[model samples]
Target: MLGLVGVDVDGTLVGTDNRVREDVWAAIERGRAAGMHFAICTGRPAVGNALEYARRLDPDGWHVFQNGASIVHARTGESLSAAFPEEALPGLLNMAHERGWLLELYTDTDMAVTQPGDVARRHADLLGIPYRPQPPEALEGTVVRVQWVVPREDEGTVTATPHPGLDLHPAGSPVMRDVMFISVTRAGVNKGSALGRIAQRYGFGMDRVMMVGDGENDVTALRAVGHPVAMGNADAPAREAARYQVGHVDQGGLIGAVDLALGL
Candidate 1:
């Protein structure tokens, strides 16, 4: 029997605009009723501000947040947090200031984002999370990860911040713009590790789980599960990782993937 299900938020399950449809929620409810353990394995940080639908997507299952930097029970909020190496924080901070790009820092309980622009404010309003404008010094005390939100059409120009020991890479859901988000975390802190840990903790075999997504950060989770599905709108990397590629989210790709996974 399929014991667990791991689905990404942006592309595979929801549409490209970051909203969850009623039909998809029905699918989640049905999956739960079918004795399948459900989890939202996303790069979104628990400490940072989230979207409105995000709150609804959560509160029902395990949250693989911060791109797998933290794993927590959504209802109880009990979690295991892994932070970046202390020795590397200084360089990361310096790089952020040099680039003048907004940096979002994530801890299990605390969050701070610098250079709050209009886009950030809009996102904050949608999620109803109060944005506390804090400086770099606020980043002290065991930061699990950092993220960069680049402006539209400027993703490619955002040069990589050299962190030999830290892992820095781009992240987002199917709904997000292409290549606009960059996530930074410790090498071992990611969705793949989180998925593996969640499966082992719940006594589910790796082969019984499904990981579906359409972004680069999702590559880890996609490779970890028995079936990795790429949305029809998935970028090249996501398509490469997935064993099966479904139609676009707006076209009811997730419903199709569910049927296909179970041979329904």
Candidate 2:
């Protein structure tokens, strides 16, 4: 039996419209009634709309945000775990500037980009939050993670470069197929590590956990759980990483995945 369930936002939980279907919410409520906990694990920042989704799903539950760079309580806003490696910021910023890449730096309070672009504007619009056009040095302090949104064609080149203290993972966005995400975090930070922490806190092992996702960044968390589910619309890498595959997000895949997890 599964004790905890972790779900990715964006493509996995909600569709391009960013709305969670009624049936999916119903399934989550059913899972909660059966004593199962749910966590909103995403590569999104911990602040803004991400927290709103987390509270809506499980107000008292843990939230794994920024691709596991931050783990916090949804309702109380207490930090269970957080990582902000300032040392990696300089190198990441330098690379972004040198490569002329549009980079967004995320803090607990705000998200800023060195220069605004279509991707940054879309992100801000999606979160319904305002972003500042600040240089990397100006947006120092309390940086949780950095992301570079590049054209899909440039993904290979951007990811090929290496930074000393940063770990890079390239992921695709369901809303923007032409774009690719280069997520940069502290060397050891990833969703898998954060899921392990959540399991430890609740006294459950990976074998008792179920996770659902549909993107490249979600691969680590999917592999960390016993019941790994990939949405039918997921990228090839994500589908290959999962133990089971369900319908697309538009077809209520989250609902199906949860039902399968609970053996309902």
Candidate 3:
């Protein structure tokens, strides 16, 4: 039996247009009702994007965030595990500053960013999210995940323009494929590590876990989980690794998968 089920938020749970379809939400509730466990396994930060899911959907389960850099229990706000060494930040942030990328910082308890602009606002709006802007001083806590935003036309800049000393990556949201951004972290921190932690903590085999994603960052999860589902809108690698190509998020792709998983 699939003991735990992992979901990708942007394209799998929410739609390419950033709308969270009612059917997908219903499917999640149905899976929970059926006694299948759920987790948000995405390239989003441990406490950044995934925290919202923890607060709303996975209140009963743990979340694997930052591509598996960290895991936390949503209700108690207790961290089950954390990845990333302190030494990795200078190089990580340096790459962002040099690349002119919008860097978003996250930790187990807090999240902040140095800047917010028109495009960023549009992204938040598209995702149906509201954010109160803050200044650079807001980065007061340790950062678990760091992200960089680049224009789609400037893709080569992030890939080659950043300081070679640091590690960085382009973060793709299958639903938001037109917009461009990149996320960077220590070498070993990613969803695979997060899944390893969860598998150890729960004493479950890889066969018990399943992941769904639709972005470049989700490559780790799509490769690591027992079942990796790619939304129709996914980036190249995510689509390639996904064992199944469900419909688009707007069309209840996730709902369909759940029905099939439960044989409903």
Candidate 4:
């Protein structure tokens, strides 16, 4: 049986409606009862709805947030987060300013945006937080990740830009499919790396880990685990990386994953 399970948030756990089904919750309870640990691995920062979900999933376990830059213990509030390469900031800041794109910066528990408007408001809603725009410099903790919130059409432009010493993981929420959230972290810091750390911390080999996800950012994690399950609605890259596939999130696909984890 798998010793650990890492799941993605938006496209894999919750659907476009942004809600977890009762059946999904019940499956998690069953998995926990069987002694399998679950972890939230996502590109989102650890705050607001995301933080709540982490605690709810495994109150005392560690979660991978900010595309793996922020690894926090939901119960103890201990962080094993990575630091943002400070040198990459000026170039990114300049890119955003030059293009007038909505850029966001994140610490372990807070986030700030450079441009705010309808996009920001919708993003805030998606994040299950109040719409509050603050300068990036105003965030109180160590900044670990940066993100570009742009229209789907602008995705290529953002990705094409040169960002040395950094890595970009582009993801889309079903809630706002036309908007791409491009998460930037220090080079080689991604969901796969973080999941590896989480497994090592628990003394589980990568072969003993299972990961379920449905987005571009999830590819790393899918490749990191022995049993990599992709959602029915998963992106092409995710599907290509996975060893197994489940139903859609809206259809309680996690229930199948939970059963698989428990060897049912």
Candidate 5:
């Protein structure tokens, strides 16, 4: 039986409305009853609505944020692992400036944008977090991840750009289709790497963990666990990486995926 389950937030647990369906919550309760723990794993920073969601589900479980750059305990607010390579900041900032894209720098606790834009405002509204407008020089302390918010159509152009020192991944929402997030992390720091660390910390082997996700950023995470369940609405790469495919989020795919993982 799986001891831990890692769920991606945007497209897996929550629907386009950014609300967890009743059935999803019920499934979570059932999983808890069966002695399984749930963790929120997403590219989002571990604050505001992101931490709130994880605390609501499993207050004591490990929560992964910044696409695995930060792992912390939901209840105690204790960090297990965090990565912020200061060396990669200059190149990432340069890339975003060259494209005239809005960049958000995330620390383990706070998020700040170089300048606010429509996409930044939309994200702030969705996450229920204030987007503090700060200069790049104010990005002090540990910077876990950097995000470039671009138009959906411009994703191709940004993807084509050469980012030699960073790992760029695409993230989008069903509700906000016009925008896409190009999340940047230090090379080799991804959801999969974070999940591995969490598993080790909890003494659960890869085979004893299950992962559910449905986006470009979720591909590596899906491939990290032994039971990788992809949502039907998942991106092509994510679906290909998973060992199983459940229904879409609208169809309570998380419930189905959990059932399969727990052998219900």
Candidate 6:
């Protein structure tokens, strides 16, 4: 039987409205009732709506966030997160400032942005948080991830830039399709590696875990899972990595994935 289900946020859970569909929530409840574990796996930081969702999913279980830079227990506030490579921070900060880019730095729960404008405001809304932009130096806790929130047209340039000791994962939200979010973590931290850690903590192999997702960043976890389920709207990389396909997120595709997990 599948022991756990890891779900992506933007495309797999919520669509453009940025709210979890009622049917998806209902299905998750049913899965929980049947003793199935559910986890929110995403590029989002562990704060605001994301934190709330993690607690709601399974308060006692582990959830992966920040593209796997964070793995926290919803109820206990305990973390099995990878720390950001501090040595790489100065160069990234300098580069973003020089380029006038919208760069964000995040700890396990708090975040700060270099550019707080329309994009930052919209992101704050999506995160279900207030629009208070704090500087990176003022943020409390161990920093884990940094992201570049730029227009879709700038994705290529951002990814092409070289940053030693950092790994970049580019992703998009259905709600902000015109924008690209480039997440940077330590050299090897990602959803796949983090999922493995979560599985080990649970005393199970990754084959017993099912991952549902629909984006480029989801590709790593998708490829690592025994049952890789993709939403209908999944990007090419995600679809290619997944072994199963569900309906679109807007149409409550998560229900199908949950049902599959329960039966498997």
The number of the candidate with the highest lDDT is 4
Candidate 2 lDDT tens digits, 59-174: 88887988888788887777755556776777777777798888888776566787676777787766657755666667655777788888999998888877677778677766
Superposed by TM-score, candidate 5 places the C-alpha of residue 66 at a distance from the truth, in angstroms, of 1.0
| Alpha-carbon shift of residue 149 in model 1 (angstroms) | 1.7
Ranking by TM-score: 4, 6, 5, 2, 1, 3
* CA lDDT, every model vs. true structure: 0.71, 0.82, 0.67, 0.91, 0.85, 0.91
Tens-place lDDT per residue, model 6, 64-85, is 9999999999999899999999
After superposing candidate 6 on the true structure, give the runs of residues whose Cα lies further than 4 Å from its correct spot.
none
Ranking by lDDT: 4, 6, 5, 2, 1, 3
Alpha-carbon deviation at 35 in model 4, angstroms: 0.2
Count of backbone clashes, every candidate in sequence: 4, 0, 3, 0, 0, 0
| Candidate 1: residue pairs that collide | 10-174, 11-174, 16-175, 43-67
What pairs collide in candidate 4? none
Better of 2 and 3 by TM-score: 2
Q: Residue 245's C-alpha lDDT in candidate 2?
A: 93
List, residue by residue over 4-26, the lDDT tens digit for candidate 4: 99989998899879999988988
lDDT for 154 (candidate 3): 75
Candidate 5 lDDT tens digits, 1-264: 798899999889988778889989898988988998888999888888889989977888888888888898998888865565777778777866776888888888877787677777788878878866677787677777888888888999888877776788789988788889888888888898888888887899988988899998988888888999899899999989998999989889999988997793
Q: Could you tell me which 10 consecutive residues in candidate 6 have the lowest summed lDDT?
A: 195-204
Off by over 4 Å in 2: none
Q: Model 5: how large is the Cα RMSD against the reference?
A: 1.5
TM-scores, all models, native as reference: 0.87, 0.94, 0.84, 0.98, 0.95, 0.97
Query: Candidate 6, clashing residue pairs?
Result: none
Query: In model 5, where do residues sit more than 4 Å from their true spots?
Result: none
Candidate 5 vs. true structure, TM-score: 0.95
